[model samples]
Target: MGTTDVVLTDTSPYGSRMVTVEYEGASSVAYLRGAGGGIHGAVWLANHGQAPSSVDLDRLGRGQAPVMPRAHTRIPEGTPPFTSAELEVLWFEEGDGAALYRNGDLLAVIPGWADLERGMPGYARDAVGESPFAWSLEEALEGLAPRIAKARSYWEWRHGDGAWRSFQQFAMSHLDTRVGPPGRYWDIGGETLPTVGITERPLDEYTVLSTVGMSCQRMPTVEQYIDRPDAYARVELAVATRHEPAEAAQLFLWLARYPWHSITWLGHGHTARWYGDAAGFPLGRSYAGVLMLDTVPGLPDMSGFAFGGDEVRWLWLIPLTDHELQIAAERGHDSLGLSLPGRIP
Candidate 1:
């Protein structure tokens, strides 16, 4: 039997007023629910099951001009305060490519291969121009629901534990895991990514906390700023410390999404000064920022890393003092190496 699932939900004004009814195999059904109640909408899909055009639901949510689908069915008289249950019942009882109604007025219609109309409300149609029709429920949800699909795919992929195994295997070749599973594995929330885990491992006398998921998706900021970014597109951050695992892991929290959050790429010899008060730093008041390195001179063999067909660069997070941060900022990160002999900590 086919299954039905709600793929996306939003509560933003007009954005929340649309709805979509999609086929579920031969016998099931699915839908998209807009947060606010509405009595008007347009239908964009047909019985042929061809994929809809891509829509940037993120942009649409900001009230940008709507991207039109190839086809649409308008509700001339609009709809009544009908429940989804009523729509489902109307769906099964009606035939394919159906235009449905209640009380002798058009409510909605499942478009068909030949049920094409270049019509939409006047205001939206004029603004978008020759775009066929106004935004439809399916198109919007299709764009916005990648996170849901990604979540489902991630759970499926997790069955093999390939990512974890790969990371652990790579890490164990250089460090030690006999200390047991990470004392803490930080999971990023609300992201479509398959759990980006910040796992803490033991490296000899020091603690090495590294990010597992940051490399799962290529960093866009990295692509925009770097040359041949694919080689550096994916990165995993590591911090070696003699301090508490919790305190050292704090560096990951700040620098984990640094490239994307700050709209830049991080690479070997890159320096990032702490943005907050000195007392709030992970290392202590003495350190003001970090210098990223591909491999620490005194650390493990953390080089030549690869995962999922992409070169995964390991950025070693080394804390720097205020004076060192200033030197790196003034002359360049490379200058710090010459200016301070024992700066690595």
Candidate 2:
């Protein structure tokens, strides 16, 4: 798309002198300068529902008004910090489970099937008549401890044998090394925090065309995904030591809609384009947000080492359209009150 640039002059509380705003199709890039001629903050606007016009630029340059086209929850300052030590559980359509990661280390993954069987000993006998079940962090950890012990023993046996050593050897070695003493291993706390519930329904009508395991063909580029007709969305869930759950939700919404540039150190590479809307269902915990993109293409499977860990993990999800989500919410499938853009729930 061709770009257009406009310069406006205005004075403001911050002593702004001139602001140059450029519009390129659905995106806008702006640079603010102070009266003293020093460059201020640079802002890039995209997927914000409306493209900024020359008149909008003129108003912004003059500081006459704000150009927010949609209502957004302001991310408060001094938000809580997100550390890698907290456990995060992601429930996808393929399987329901909790992935336990502590300080960038993969502790264990307890599948929902296993959780159900263990949580309710008579689940098999009552499988036909059992009601839906809800899993909690405490239950996840309860199942996780034995799994961790089994993993540690397996790693110790395999590593000590020295017959199956590989580049991945160090990761397992660290697992054993990190377990300092018994009864103090794997930081399972006694309290339970607020848990965020996630519900996923299949989009059987739409199929995401992308690369999969060992395919030599290049994966679809982000631009290709953007050009596709199918509606898509992204939901990001994160946990950390310190940070307000709401603040993280707001940040996730902002990142999904805005074409913000960031550096991520995980998987094989870190270059990614985050474009969409700043509206999403907030997973009520520390640093967890879900972004749902509409009418966009599906994203290719990407992997990275989050929290500077050796375990490479693939990140992928299927985003539901507003209509689909609304239907689900109306059916009372999700109690979290998941809503679409411009929706107040």
Model 1 lDDT on a 0 to 1 scale: 0.50
Q: Cα RMSD (Å) between model 1 and the true structure?
A: 13.0
TM-scores of all predicted structures: 0.50, 0.18
Kindly report which residue stretches of model 2 are placed more than 4 angstroms away from their true locations once superposed.
Answer: 1-148, 151-302, 306-321, 324-345
Query: How far is 76's C-alpha from truth in model 2 (Å)?
Result: 65
**How much is the lDDT of residue 271 in candidate 1?**
87
The numbered model that scores best in TM-score is 1
lDDT of 2 by residue, 165-219 (tens): 3322332232233221111111111122111121111122321111111010011
lDDT value for model 2: 0.27
Q: In candidate 1, what are the lDDT values of residues 1-345, reduced to their tens digit?
A: 234333222221112222344333211112222233422333322222222345536644753333333243233222223334444212111011223333443333332121123444211211122233333433434432443344335435544558556655564444343234455666653332223567777656777677766665555435335667568867888877777878777777777755443324678888888889999998777889888888666665555656545788888887888898888878987776542224435
Off by over 4 Å in 1: 1-194, 261-263, 338-341
